[model samples]
Structures are given as structure tokens and as C-alpha cells.
Target: MPAARPPGGVTVRRLTARDARALTTLPPAMSWIHRTWGGPEALARSGCAWAAFQGDRIVAVACTYFLGTTYEDVACVTVPDPRLQYLALDCVDALCADMAARGHTPSWTCSTSNRPGRLLAWTAGFRPEREYAHYAVGAPAATGRAAAG
Candidate 1:
């Protein structure tokens, strides 16, 4: 299915390297492309970024990180403006369509504490899958040494 036409004059399209600069202007929270993916050039190189635009202004972004050939981890970020939040759904639709064309299943993890993220994932056709506890080990301690004890 094609992406839905946003209620306003918004449009959705695949993002390119040129879109990188605009992404920097986004609020820090909404600019994960830069923080996590090394900016738009790297994201475009990965070939899995899309954006919702109101004229020339970017309102939302969606990206997928492929896991081997079978699954894709999806993520999205949107402008803080509540009025533009709906654009995220359009981004999700577009990302799903792209994943379908590539023969991959798309999935995302939302923190149990993030009600909004969980709701959006559910609304986008994601079902509850197996839940696993997540564990992280921080960088090595000082003294230029690493110890787990």
C-alpha cells in the first residue's frame, strides 16, 4: 500500500544524502540519525531512511537496521510539534512497504515504560513477541583496564 496523504500539505519520501543537513536542525531527540547512525550520509549509504516533509521542512524520519537477511529493526523520530505527529504513521507505512519489497520482516522494540511507543508499534500491526530482559555492560573502568568482577 502506498503511504497515506497527510492531512495537511505534507509529503513522504525516501531520504538521500542531501537530506542530512536538514536533519541536523531537528531537536536532539528527533535527530537520532546523527547520534546513532553517524548522520544522513551514513544512513543514506545504508539505504533505509525515509522522511515526512511539509514543503521543504522535515517533520518526521523512519529508518530500519537490517539484521542479517531476515529481520529489520525499525525506528522512528518526529518533530516535537504535536500537530505533525501523524506524519510518523505515514513514515511507518512507507518503511513497511519498502521492507516488503525487500522480502524482510520489520520489527521494533519499545521500552515497557514508553506507553506511546508501545501504542504506536501496536497500531502499526506489530504484535507482542517474546520479551527478553536486556543487559548492558558499560565501558571499561578507569586505569585503562577492564574488569567484570
Candidate 2:
């Protein structure tokens, strides 16, 4: 299926090196564009990412953040603005469609508390497949596991 049409005044396209500046404006929580893809420079080079923009401002982005044996981990975020409704969905739909064309299954994950993300995934036909928890721990400590000989 063709991707849903983005909202008027919003345009979606493949992420490029020029977007590095706009990507920097995202807050830490939306830093997946950095942490997962090693910043906009890398993501642009990967050619597996897309962004929604209103002129020079990046309003949303969807990217394959991880690659498993048979699926691509999908991540997306939109600027926090109520007026930008449907913006993220449009961006995600376009990205998912492109991934499908490339034969990559998309795996989307988000904290259960993220209602907006969940809703967007749902709207994009993604259903829950598994549930897991992640923790932010301090510096790694070595466990006393003897090496197998």
C-alpha cells in the first residue's frame, strides 16, 4: 500500500546529512536518533531512515534502529505538539512501506506508558508480540563465573 499522505505543509523524505542540525534539537528522551544510529550523520549515511519536515524544521523521524536476524527494530518520534497530529503516523507509514519494499519486517517497541507511541503503532497495524523490561544500571561489574575449559 502506498503510504498515507502527510499533513499539509509537512513533507517526508530520506534523512540526509543536512538534517544533523535539526536532529540535535531533540531532547534526551528522543535521543534514539543519536543513541541507536550514532547520531544523524550516521543515520543519514545508513540510508534506512526518513524524516518529516515542515520546511527546515524536522517534525518527525522513523528509522530502523537495530537489525535482528530477520527483522528491523523500528523507532520513531515526533515533536511534542498537539497541533502536529497525524504527522508521526504519516512518517511511520512511509518508513514502514519502504521497509516492506526492502523485505524487512519491522519490530516496534515502546514503553507501555507511552500512549502516543502505542497508538501510532496500532494505527500502523503493529500488534504486541512480546513484553520485556530494560534497566539502566551503573558501570558493569564482573560476575564470578569461572571460564569453561
Q: How do the residues 1-149 of candidate 2 rate in per-residue lDDT, one tens digit apiece?
A: 33457667888898878778878877767877657777767887677878888888888888887877678878888888876777777777778887888888987988988987898898889999888888888877655655332
lDDT of each: 0.76, 0.80
Candidate topping lDDT:
2
What TM-score does candidate 1 reach? 0.81
Point out the worst 10-residue segment of candidate 1 by lDDT: 140-149
Best by TM-score: 1
RMSD of each: 4.2, 5.9
Instruction: Give the runs in model 2 whose Cα sits over 4 Å from its true position.
Output: 1-4, 135-149
Where does candidate 2 clash, by residue pair? none
- TM-score for all predictions? 0.81, 0.80
